[model samples]
Target chain A: MVTAVRAWPRPAGRAPAVLGILCTAVGAAFVASLAVGAFPIGIGRIVEILADMAVPGNASGSFDQDAAVLLSIRLPRAVLAVCTGAGLGMAGAVMQGLFRNPLADPAVIGVSSGAALGAAIAIVGVSLLPTAFRVAGGFLLPGAAFTSAVITTALVYRAGRQDGASGMHSMLLAGIAFNAIAFAGVGTLSFIASDEQLRNLSFWSLGSLGQASRDLVMTSSIAAAVGALLLWRLAPALNALALGAAEAAHLGVDVRGLERRAVLLVALVVGALVAATGVISFVGLVAPHIVRLACGPDHRIVLPGAALFGAALMLAADAVARTVAAPAELPVGVLTTAVGAPFFLGLLLRARRASGL
Target chain B: MRGVLLAACLTLAVTHASAAPPARVVSVGGAVTEMVYALGAGTALVGADSTSIHPSEAGRLPRVGYMRQLSAEGVLSLKPALVLATAEAGPPAVLEQIRGAGVRLERLHVRHSPEAVRENIRTIADALGRGTAGDALLQRFDADWRATRTRIAGLPTRPRVLFVMAHGGAPMVGGRDTAADAMLELAGAANAASGITGYKPLTAEAALAAAPDVILVTDQALEAGGIDALLQRPGLALTPAGRAKRVATMDAVLLLGFGPRLPQAVDELATKVRAW
Candidate 1:
């Protein structure tokens, strides 16, 4: 990121100012996210609904239809977008810092594919169980996803590690190999699903914020908050690792344990995010890249900055996704990819030029 | 006499109000859309989802996107009075929002059986206040259903049938408790993939073991490279049906819709099954 940004370097003493800008962007983006949707609710109504809901006694009754929509639909969706983006972005930042690989994204460990395959199996394979065990309800898919994430990470760790040490090259290759296998498994699972189940599965895999309920928002927020804390706590260690494992160990860092814990943290955040909203791409990857371009490669600044940037970017993309079709919605994942891919490419090109490659 | 005249005016007003616009109805599923049209309530439709592609007119209607992935504002853009959808309709949040907005959202139950289809006809008909049309549609449905059954009733043997569904990767055969299985039974054919409970990937050994006499596919599958591609599949080509080249195809929506046109689909299927 530094090499690429050499041509257009950020001014000195700009970090604080950039952070301030990102904070404001996320704040304004949050309000804008709530204000604009397929529904015609105005900013005034949204504010009023929130204000009313905030006051304990005023929650009585007759809040109006717009209030229900504002409070029930858009608000929760916006919160989820923020939470998911923050989690993914923070995860991506830490992953790049820890792995010391700029190209590494959130699911670089194959959690997304494993989680997806887990969901597919839950949807289709559960019905084949005996009548006593056949009643895997709404939680089944998400539960399966989380479980599969943990298992896949464990398996990848086992395969990539060699006699008390881990290899980044092997780990990445394992992610790729496991991802392919998981997708193939998903393909097999889709075949066994009833057409209705298939449609629902495909609909979910499309990754919409349309499933935003208050409970899901709250749950996702808590998980993301915990994940952010975990990632933030590891920033110094990550900074050490980014300089190379030998130097980090020389600096008194436990290199092997650090690698294991970092991977574990990535798995947890990726699991929660993927299980809740299906798989989202690039928020984690580009958020960090953009932050590195603005704030330099310090993990302490990079991690939190990426979190804010990712949350803001996700909400903005979600807003576009919500209104572009109006009365119809493109998947949030699709919108994010469209914007993230180009920006990411530009960053890569700049990086390549800076490196004189 | 003045009282009598006022009463008559009230009755006339009610009937005229109902007849004038028939209420702006929005349909979220293909079958519900078809049923609305079948009940002569097609003009009432202000918006429809992407799945509502029957009768050509539905195609011309403003689309609301996929049935399961709806947006309330897009659906409400038409300001519809009645929203007819299937049980499969919605991201659930959008449906709730539409209902919260005070539009009457009717989520008709979908069971993928003949009984459910009848209930669907009655429900859509009742929603549109077209009881007579609904009844007449039911009779045509009954006659067609009976005709299909009767024609194949005296057959010496029911051909073992398989429904192959593949968008990508390995193909799968439809098993029990599926629309394909139900459709096969309705057409008086035995489901070849009966040992399984639902759709699953078919192995070459499994395909060979099923020993299907006839293979049915959707028109979409057929269009995706025709029967040749299906027969050329590594696992399927060795099957008895593939070897004999006994493949038939139907429009995916109509074949699986289980809507007002289900009787037609069943008849079309039975005719193909009777051959060979």
Candidate 2:
């Protein structure tokens, strides 16, 4: 049935041009994010500062902390927003293509829940370790999150495989099962968590780019970039798999290998995102679906378009998060969902009408 | 010519802005607000965070919600000239944004001690241009501190006290370097949970292993199960505190704020511990 849909003719080249336009628009949103911030810095001042940063800062400082805030806080936050959005979007697009199911999100395969459980354990369980052994900072949370995502993905893939063929239905069901188990794990951590740990868990669960440090932003962005690019490169293979796994195998695609790679890539990208921003839901689901509807079901266009749109949407949401409260922030994760879900439902209705569903 | 004109305008604006220290202050952390009141400049405060629940009037001040969860717009609505916050008083981006809004953001270190309290009073007072008031508060606090030291020096035995943050089956117990730990140490009492540093949720068996002679809690914790029920809880029932009904409650702010009234708080707790 999925292959039947794949045989539906798509106008080539036109989609890529549309995708290029989308990227430029997303790039514009990224610049807009850089311009607006809680800081009293104007667009004029921001332009001067960004230019100044390149010119060795006029050799010695024009006000230190203000410059530090721009360099350290706002820049990284905007960058991370774009990178994390791209990562999640590409991962979602890849997952949907691999599963040949419009409903598949990067998290639907249990990787995100597993990542949350991993983070919960790091935040809560670290207290149990001797102080000397527990290393703190940017690495531990993401490391644990990524590790758990990989482990969970491997588990789901193994479970989904029967008679040397991976079943998308089985993979999704396995994801559901793993997600439940991960929830129980998180529950156990919460049960034993300290007041501080509980606070950490609560804020982290909401997720934000508010904690975007330069190093964290750089590392997460790189990981996300790599994951998105790898998945984007695998676009043709994903497109092949959409023709049903067995039929794709007959068409010279390595069905079993492609499944493993896709899941691994999703885990790496989405897990890094969850680690950084703490489970930003709906962007992955909504971004790619919007792209698919706009550009048709061509994997090549859907893949890159979703990534760009995701970045732009995340940046816009983050801007609202920063300024809506002025001196306080809404977690970007909450804003994305609150804003994205309605638009998504509307788009879904539109898609249903277009497809005569 | 255009560039030079822009520079002149920029410098003039920057100079004028820096010349005036803010008269309208927003205090973000509990301890920082307490110090502002202690410095006798409470009138300067237009707003404070939810954590600033000291001196009854502070509760009446417009709140910015929890210190960790400040709303940027809510805080900005008060139009504070200076926002005094602790190191932990943020979602960093919000604070950064607040700083960017041309507000003087004074973020003080939240050390858990009487010295930190004194320093906080002095710093905030200095900011408010009330150095004389800060000096007077410091001297009086010093005298009280010396008296407490003398009383604590004469103590024959330091009973082990465990500071449990909550009583209704909470796993968390306060350990070293916390305000509770400092209070016990200053009051001539040993913290039973010293083996583990910071607040942690040890297992019921592990918590009982600390073998506390008394359990210290804030009145806020009573909301969970009340003193009677808290005393009867599983791990708590095995402690010497449970056996003798030696659980003592104090105001959370008074116990942990580490503010201007800390020396008095220390004396009161020290006396209670001695009597126990």
Candidate 3:
């Protein structure tokens, strides 16, 4: 069915325009997030509040509580959601191109698991350190996760090499091994943790945006933006790689450099997000696939389109998380699974039918 | 005048005091054990749950297994005449079995309110033939509690606080209706995470949302990532609590245990919050 779909002609510029509309829709949802919550604030109040914040001494009693709520809570959450979503989406797009497989994701490379293990160690092992040594442990977790991810990818790349040539299958197997090892490490940490620590670890491992702050959001967004831009520059090369390494090299693509840069960028984006949020699953896996369905296989359109769609999906999921249980919010990751799993299954079934498999 | 004299004579002839029954005592919970000890009737305690770990000497007594996972065999082994228990003390079946065995079990109410605590103390005292002792202890406890609270009452502002029970992984926080909240209120500090109820896992985002002035946690919990781990948690690092090094650590058992030494814990907490 995928090949059949590929045979169909698509109108020029339609996908980008559709993506533009999706971006606007996501932006509107972001605004809606600012307006709705336990505080009972409306859109008018939200606008007024933003206006007041922008202009000092602008007397607006209508937006006082709304302003406080937005400035203090909603804005940070929305921004974080966008950054996380965009990062995951772009990373997914890059992975799919590099692997020449639509199913490729950040998780397939064990980046999320590695980051989670790092976070768990930071949380569980920091207590044993001296007071002077304790000050660095917080950043150390994420730092460790990033380092581990880079190392893991390097090792994966190395192990996947056959007579100085690497293939998607070898990379996939290495990723599986890395993910299993990281999960085992996390399990060990969980086992030795105190009952209270165990509870906290479980919740953290589930992934949440509850910790998104202005600084965190900014840092994560910047990292993701950088990754997206780099991936955009490498799009034509990625497109060539999709046709197979031998064909791509023959077509003047530096397959090794392309693979290295793409893997590194994915690691950085996934590591930064996971470090901040603790292993939010499925966004990277689903976002690229969804965008591909709408826009087809061209990396030029697929990369940017995935970023916008991914942000929209995550923000919508987060909005659902905040409101579904009212004041007691569910974890953002849980909400994603509840939505993403079904969508994923549907895609799988559709693909099976299309392929006659 | 003669009618008044007849009424006085009748009142004098009618002595209204009756001897109360000695509580057939089966103290079924840890808190109940402490209360029993507070009531000066530790000897009357026929049995206790595994969590009744206070007063040091209470451990030598027979254990009735864990608090929620009660065993009928362990409880019935004591052959308690009357069972005094906290609301949390049971696997309902074990409690029922004990009751079916003709054991008189009184469920002592647990509350976060100061008045409730005093009343519970009095109720336990009354059951143990030491009502006067309960009254006297309460008076002292109340006086000291008020004195400590009053000292901080004059402070210009109260600190917004977050009470973290566990550190590392996901940090669990105390919201409304929790022992941590009750303790914070008594210490004259506001709970940052008051929007929810009970013990909830606070997201880094929610912690940042609360923007606590003081991050309160137990020593053991803080040790997980030490100060670094606390600071590294998304929103926590930028908060006043994280910035000013206003993180306060208290003994976990004393802070949430709600035992005989809570007044002291309150005093210590108030001092820390005031300084913060």
Candidate 4:
């Protein structure tokens, strides 16, 4: 059904304007995210509270609950949401470009499942680990997830290589196979886990931005920013990649080198983001498609456009997650799908109608 | 063990602190909330996590989400003076954020033992400045516990009890180290599935092999699938308990909550098993 709307008109000249509008939408969503939560602080009060933090010696001379909530809880969470969404969106775009398939997303490379298996192991085996590892405590799940994602990516890349040359079909097949294996590993771990540990695993798998902290936001922001920037710079090569690998090679693009860098960069960005937030489904898969359907197949525009749209989408979804249920929050991953799917479907319908399909 | 020591030391630390007792409290664990109510400090509870379902009044309080997946803003919205949580309540980062926001958070150690329950009661009582009430409640609990133990000790034999929780998929049997197992032991009964380390799905062979005299089921599980349906499962019908139709059902929270109601739960189970 989606394939019926595949032929979008190439409006290359409007790229800069679309990117600008997307950037502004992301900014507005970030502000809205901070303004809404279980705690109700008016927009004016939110501005004043944030502005006070910027100034020196502005303690209101009393315990400020609003300021405490706005600063410690909402601010870091919003920042982390933006960083994570940006990373996932950019990685999705790169994967689609590298694979030459519009449906491909970051998960196609085995990141999500690999992370799932790693986190499952950490949850089920934490008690048996030595004190040194046990003492790491809070970092254990995320660290294991990130490490395994990298390992799985490396394995996928190595297995897909034939006599010093990388093949896209082989790589895709390897990823699908690894995903199945990883899922089975997770199932086995679930079978052995204690009740509390099983609850933790389910919560982790459902994803949430509620765990955002200053340290996590700082590190993930840097990683996402670096990865996004590097990928953005490679846009031209990626566009060349769209003309088929053999054709791109004849035109002076090093197909194998580009593929290696793309895979590595996506793994780094996606691994960090997913490790922090758990498995946030739909964003990576849907964000790029929405961008391409709106604009064109040009990677230069699609890459940045998807990242901005993804950031906005996550910010809006997370805000709803924390507010819709009041004090009892829904998982953000659930909200993302609930929010993204209908909106994505609407866009597809419009695309089909416009194409006379 | 470290968590137990930490909770013990924190209890002492709270005892020494002379700060005014909190007027607004948020409780994150089910057991912690029960203790708060038992100490007559329920009036101070402005919010509680989803697990806090007992006392009926706790259900009316604003919910701050599940203990493990807490939202800092949700808890802070109540503007609580103090937050009482089990050591298990956390994604870890949210707890740190709540602390950073200047809320006093006390994490009580929870284990499936009467002593752990007593420690929690003491910790909550001290934190709420209800030490006199705590002492009276402890005395009453000891009396009930001693009486129950004496009654159980006079029994001719300890029944091999199986705990089957069947909310979804295959029914899982509680084994050694589980709260269900500990509760059975406290009730002067042997755990049928003690050979397994924790909870494991009941295979027909394993269920037949266990051959428990009495089966205990959570009220929630019983509600999901009736007692007849449960007994009719694969190898369950072949078990001694199933053939005899001897099943005991109790609220999971009451039997496993490990709070102020621990003695009452033990007394109830001991009575039921002794009668059989």
Best by DockQ: 4
When summed lDDT is taken over every stretch of 10 residues in candidate 4 chain B, the lowest stretch is B1-10
Identify the superior model by DockQ, candidate 3 or candidate 4: 4
Docking class of 1: acceptable
Residue B120 lDDT in candidate 1: 89
Off by over 4 Å in 4: A1-11, A56-63, A164-166, B1-20
Task: Name the runs in model 1 displaced over 4 angstroms.
Answer: A1-12, A54-60, A126-136, A154-188, A254-257, A351-357, B1-22, B76-81, B92-104, B154-157, B160-173, B192-215, B220-247
Ordered by TM-score, highest first, the candidates read 4, 1, 2, 3
lDDT of 1 by residue, A1-357 (tens): 122212323335667788899999999999888888766877677777789889888875653767766777777788888888888899999888877888888677887888888888887877667866654344566778878987888788777876644477788888888888888998877765776679878877777777655666677678778878887877777776777877777667777787788788888877877777887777888999898887688777788899999899889888998889876778888889898889878987988899899
- Docking model 2 quality class: incorrect
Q: DockQ, in order, for the candidates? A: 0.42, 0.20, 0.02, 0.59
lDDT tens digits, residue span B179-227, model 2: 7998898888999999876777756776589888888888888776777
Q: Candidate 1 local accuracy as lDDT?
A: 0.80
Q: Give per-residue lDDT, candidate 2, residue A129.
A: 77
Question: Residue A283 lDDT in model 1?
Answer: 89
Q: What lDDT tens digits, residue by residue, belong to model 4 across residues A1-357?
A: 122123324546777788889999999999889988888789899989978888979868987878888887898889989988888988999999999998899888898899999899888989889989787677778888888888888888888866544488899999999999999999999988988899999999999998867777777788888988998866777777788887677667778888889999999999888888899999988889988887787887889998999999999999999988878789999999999999999999999999899
**Model 3 agreement with the true structure over B151-268: per-residue lDDT tens digits:** 7677667889998877555677888878889999888889999997666666878887898998988877976667677777777887878877778888776777675566787878
Best by lDDT: 4
User: CA lDDT, every prediction?
Assistant: 0.80, 0.78, 0.71, 0.86
